[model samples]
Target chain A: MTIYENKYRITYEAFSKFSAKLSKANDKAELLEIVQKHLKYFFNFKYFRVLLKDEVFLKSFHVFHNSNNSPEFILNEFFSYEEDLLKNHIPIQHSSNGEFLNNYDQKLNLNNGKLWAWYFKYQDLQLCVSLISDDEKPFIVRDIEILNLLIDSFVTKYQQIKLKNRLHQKNVNLKNAINVIEEQKFQISKIVYNQKNTIEQRTKKLKDQNSKLAEISRLNAHNVREPLSRILGLLEIAELYEEKDLKKEIFEKIKTSAKDLDHILQDIIYKSNNAIEKLSSKTPPTK
Target chain B: MMPDKIKIFLVDDQKIANFITQKLLQTSNIDCEVLAFDQPIQALDAVEKDLPNFIFLDLNMPKLNGWQFLEQMQKNITSKVIILTSSSDPADVEKAKDFPQVISYQTKPPSREILQELILG
Candidate 1:
């Protein structure tokens, strides 16, 4: 096979493997590890850095790097340079001789070697990648093209991860709402059951009271009539008497009969008051 | 001419009731020999020896109530009973009708008109 054909085959195979690993990454940390592995395999570099900012949270920045030392100095200079590039709406592909090249070289102590810098904006994210090589060979246009394609796929995978996280959070909220509704339903049914029991008890009490009143009514008709009838019979006999002594005797019997009638009336009143007190003393059910 | 003497028996728990009933019978001036007993046992003993033509009985008593007296007399004696009681209850009046010897039910104190009608009948 020709050398050019073999190079194309190797690039295709590497990109396919990187995509497979990227798809398996579940979070930001895992995605960064997969990106670092692939980038290191594809290029020769003494220093590599990725600086990213999300438009939604402007102050928060993510920095990923593969250097033994911290890349804070390179990050500070990269953000300052990024402002001008964004104003001009220009995508950057810079080597050693480019403007702002000295800033990265000085901060990273690159010893005047070749550096490849790339800037890309994908939806809400601003991304920058930088690589420093001590070799004299400059980066080719083909390398920039491959870097841009990889960045595009990385942005898409990151957005998918964000969407999946949001969907999971919404599901948790919905489950909590359903649980609250079930608890309310159970409480309402319990209240209804308690109310039904109270009503049944009250009805039974009222029925007993009604039967007692009926018994009192029976006594009024039967017992009270007895004394009243004696009084009436004595009056009938008194009307027929003429002799003074006999009339006096009839008068005494009439007085005794009248007293008996009065006593029966008092008994009826006493029983009726007792029934009233029993009814009034009953307490209503509380919540 | 005086009518033939009609023998009458009176039984009651109350002494005043029996006295008043006896006086009312005498006031009526009927040609009758009336015998009064406050205790139903004494009246029952007299009734077993000589059954009277008519009996006036009170229902509410301490022992041997008027109904019991009637039950005892109903088997052998053919005397007519007039239930003279303080109770004017229709249930008591209806129960009195169950005895074949009971001719009438009257509430106390027995009036002159009722005594006269009973003696004449």
Candidate 2:
């Protein structure tokens, strides 16, 4: 509606476009470096610094900035009222007269040329923006709004890059675990196959031994009876001279033993014949 | 009661087996005279001199097997033979019947019942 309002709206639109330019990144270091470049180029700010306090319960802060040199804040004064300031739980960006601000200015010899600061409530850390124009009174309100806009966009980009790095590392670890498991499975299957082959070989060997034992037993039984039968028969005839009455009983007993010899011979013949039959069957039928 | 004059012959390749069988024969006929032979040839050679009425023979042997000895003894003596062995073969039984003098076949240290019937039946 008004010219000043129109100019403010245009600046806001430009800042909004810079904020919307956040993209997925691979690492935290690269994301922070890009945010430093964006503050210098997009916002046209001479100096910008971001001090991030460790969110994992460590009371230390990491500062990323356009300048490589550390700020001249006295360590004791900076930490003196830090606890109470953090516990207040409100955005400290609007506090131009806070204890930390006065302490920081005194330590840095700062006369304030467009110095702006914002302390994010979520992270107890400060974002400092300055025009670096000496001898000019600081445009604190206007620059603080600009610094807040830049910090918002930077935080969003940092989070995006951190999430990307975590997901990428997780994917790599998962793939390595799967490869290890698959190799183990392959080795186990090979062992099982070898064991099965060994069992089959042992079974075949036992069967062969059993068949050989059977053959030996049969051969042994065959050879023992003939001489025994002959002896008994001769004894029977011999008994006629010594014991005439016992001759008949000896004859009957000899007859019974002869029958046993006959039975064993028949069994040997049957077994040998069966062995021959099996051997013939195993031989591929000749035309 | 077997007569003391009844000559009993023991035959086998293994010396221990021959000794055990000879001992068993002594228990049965207290007065019988027992003669042990390790080789088939030696037994066949003394068949006439020994004139044993009761002859125990083993079939599995080195030079002359029981079957060969039986054939040889058939020509020399009318002695009765009883096969003593650790075997149980049907082929052996069939061969035993082939010899007319082979009257009975007895298995190892022949069972008391079988020996009692053969000697005292």
Taking the tens digit of each residue's C-alpha lDDT, what string does model 1 give over B1-121? 9665888999987666776677688878787898999889999999888778899998887789998888887888888899998777688899998999999998876778878997796
TM-score of predicted structure 1: 0.57
For model 2 chain A, the run of ten residues with the poorest summed lDDT: A57-66
lDDT of 1 by residue, A210-255 (tens): 7877767866875666666655656655656777865576777767
Best by TM-score: 1
TM-score of each: 0.57, 0.45
How many residue pairs of model 2 clash at the backbone? Answer: 32
True-contact fraction in model 2 equals 0.04
Best by lDDT: 1
Please provide the root mean square deviation of candidate 1 (C-alpha atoms, Å).
Answer: 8.0
Error of 2 at A101 (Å): 14
Q: Give the alpha-carbon lDDT of every model.
A: 0.72, 0.59
